[model samples]
Target chain A: MARAQELAMRDYVQEVSALTMRWVHRLRREKFSMLFTLVQPMLFWLIFFGSLFQRAANSEVMQAPNYMSFLAAGVVVMTVLNNGLSGGVDLLFDKENGFLERLLATPIHRSSVIISRFIFVMTITSLQILVILTVAYFFGVHPATGLLGIAVVLLIGMLFGIGLTALSMAMAFTVKSHGDFFSVLGFLSLPLIFLSSALVPLSAMPTWMSMLARFNPMTWTIDAVRPLILSGWSQALPRIGMVVMLLLVFDALCLYGSTRAFRRAIG
Target chain B: MGRTVAIETLKLAKAFGDVKAIEHLSFQVWEGEIFGLLGPNGAGKSTTLRILLTLLRPTAGHATVFGHDVVQEPDRVRRLIGYVPQERAIDRFLTGREHLLLLGSLYHLPKDETLRRIREILKLVDLEDRADHLAKTYSGGMKRKLDLACGLLPNPKVLFLDEPTLGLDVQSRLRIWDYIRRLKERGITVVMTTNYLDEADHLCDRLAIIDGGRIMALGSPAELKAGLGGDVVSLTVGAADMDRVESLAKSLKAVPSIRAISTKPSGIDIRVESPEKALPAILDAANQQACRLEFIEYHRPRLEDVFIAQTGHAIREEFPSGE
Candidate 1:
């Protein structure tokens, strides 16, 4: 029995790895797109938004050394959110071109296909986060928890990103076209990003808005990651633990929804 | 008939809401033979292939691949078959070699074994020289060949080619036909669906003719053609007298059977037995009725005539726009 289980696990790993490599090869071929995804967020946080709020750092309303330091964590998490939500475009194109049907006709476990999408999104999101951090460091913004905090921030981004990526995949299977997908993305992205503490801290927001941000998973992630970049481990560890638990629950729900949608679409 | 059954469907049915895609679809594909499902557009051929490939669930009844139930054991069914759908499924960014390697891994082949098979398939499909280039740069025919190469990577027991030559120039179509023949030589069972009668007649060892979700006829191409009798006699009458010409031809005793008498824009087509003998009688009858004979011709029966004889409508008429 144990031998059979081991063999099954090995097969699952092999299938996921193979499917994930398909997306990896695509990323390598479309280097311009990768460069754009990475650069767009840095351009916003470092150059545009950083200078916009540079003078606010000395005011009581902003409680950090510089706005860039405060906004750096937000930008990292935003990159994760943006990449995760748009990840389903690949699946959409696959469906339109009949590649998804070909993949479903194979003997590989169905969930492995979805898992590969998450792996691809998370991999790209990790690289984007690393680049953003490196750029922020040169501009005099450093993590209080140092290398360990950077690792924690990556974990937080991954946990949060997985749920969004799974949700996007579910939408990909359910929607009829890329137009519908773009509409849904346009409808949800700005609201989710703005409602969270990515741009402004919850304490600086209206009481009702702050309360609503508390329920947003993105808010939980940004709150955990912000202290790691702005303060030290003493202020960030508890919130980091809470965000991990919250993200686990979110991923479970999103994965369940996506798997169900996938089955229906393939059937 | 002595061969083992590779795929069997018993009263299989599928429906999309109120639209019945396939109903009571029952047929047996012999092992190591090239079997075809021939029909025009919207004739349930694709739906049947989808069910057999375990890509769709049957609305009623059952289908089995190598004795494994399609719905109950889809993974097992999938393991035994490789499907190349009508629509092209090539990713533009991935090179031909990468596509094969990716599918090979999905099939659970060992890394070294997959590489070996990829090399072999690239050669088999005559794509070795360009296998490392991005598929986006390949022509339509080359893309199709690459798709076929990917399907062959697993070396499945049964290969399903759904309209494998649907949209291709003559040379590419013939190349695919050669690949299907080679697949048969290796003892792999092939189940293909095509609306092209010539393709079905030349490539399939036996075929089932489907129309509107039902099988109208089933047999080898020769058997089906032979069933329509000996020869076809076509008469082109003046456009105004086409109906009179059809009625006159039907009145002849020498032309025992009127396989199909369809009105063309210019004249009428009349298929009958022993056209050499029937031709004179047909012309005499037309002359007796003073029906103008613009043209007349006689030829051996073909699969298209067989389809018209069985279904009472030409395959082209079924899909006028040529889907």
Candidate 2:
């Protein structure tokens, strides 16, 4: 029984931590990519795209102090969405290069592969969101909910990221090549972002567009996050419950799909 | 006589959808010996290795490692095995030491023991000096060494190497071959797959020559080659005529020292008891046949000859000489 218990400890927490650190170590060695991760959202999205509509987008319809502040939340969640979607690129490359086969042959809890991926993606996404929020503060957009609210905002982003990561991993296992995955990403990302309240308020979108955006998990997450940055819990609390419940269902469906995909692919 | 079996497959078969990868393959791996599966690219060598590693389930047979069923008890099977795949399996950004350290934990070695083992393994693979360097900085040979080091982190009882020396320079291939030879000294049973004739001939104590998902022959290299009767003297005739080759073969059969006669695409092969005494007689027969002799050569039987004797085709046909 003692030996049995020793074997039980063989794989979960230990394997996940080691694998997650492996991902972090890879990122650290690639200094150029790490530096770009910090600045890309601020440069491409907040500074340029946010500025395009800053003076034009009405503040009342956006439900924020200004369009840049409203777009700040959108950018954070967009970063999360992008990071989550690309989370499985490493695993796919591993598969193509034969590391995945090597990994699978080892005596590991196979689920640790997925768990480590989740931890790695979330950690990087958190760091990117922090940088984006810091840059937004420089643009005069402090969270109305302050320090505790920022934690809550990060938590909401993470909850939203979990579902996207699972779906992305499913795509990784299902698709034949990274080229196919990128094509799938192009097809999904822009339409989902444009249709949602990320760049424009849902209230301002065409009825047909709004109907589609209502079904997007991204829209639900952005709606929940937009208020936390612009208003306190009192305004954000009601939407938070609905979005959390919605995300739970969304994550369950994605998790189920990805579990099947993973089993089929690995087997 | 009380030898132990390390691995055994009982009429193992596997199919991917409609395509059969392995068919009724049966073999036993004796303990503490280097066993090789020799085959071409699509010959089910990797598939057999994968099934034994418990990475793939066989469609219609059973495989066991140390008496544990691979399909039913993979965790037990896995704990006893390590795999180095065809490619060098390393993350380019991770240092050699980092890869080993992570593998140490992944294999569930205790913290202090993992550190101790890492030190020992780095030294063993001669990576101690470059241990702190990222894998990308390493040469192709160095990357393969790091991969081998990681495979040893678990101290597995049986190690699976799929095409261990593949795609390496001759020097690097020799180095890896040296490493594999030493693995036997450490008493780790090795199961490797390779299509390279020299890799199998020099390294394996015994091997199975497989093709089209079936074993064509199985024995020690010496045993299999010795089964070819005797030395082979191949005469490459300049003509493309099969009838002329057959006629020459018929004429060559009359030579007193010749044991057997066979036809090749470009010439005739005569198995002789001894090439030296038969050389003059065979040359006389060739001279009488009045066919222009392109080239004539004789050598002790090689494993390739054994494969040809069993399967009627050269294994080297898969790879052109340039590759």
DockQ of each: 0.87, 0.73
Give per-residue CA lDDT, model 1, range A212-231, as digits (tens): 88888889899999999998
- Model 1 residue runs over 4 Å out of place are A57-59, B239-250, B253-266, B318-323
- CA error at residue A252 for candidate 2, angstroms: 0.6
lDDT of 1 by residue, B1-323 (tens): 47799999999999999999999989999999999999988999999999999989999999999999999999999899988878889899999999898898889989999999988888899999999999999998999999898788888999999999988988999999999999999999999999998999899999999999999999999999888777776677777785675566456544555555655566666766566666777777788888988877777888888888788787876443331
What Cα-based lDDT does every candidate model obtain? Answer: 0.87, 0.87
Question: For residues A1-267, what per-residue lDDT tens digits would candidate 2 score against the true structure?
Answer: 998877677556788899899898888788697678545844589988878888898988887778899899889888888888888888888877888877788778999888999999898888788888998899898998998888888898889889999999998999989999999987988887888888888888999999999998888898888888898789899989999999899889989999999998888
Clashing pairs in 2: none
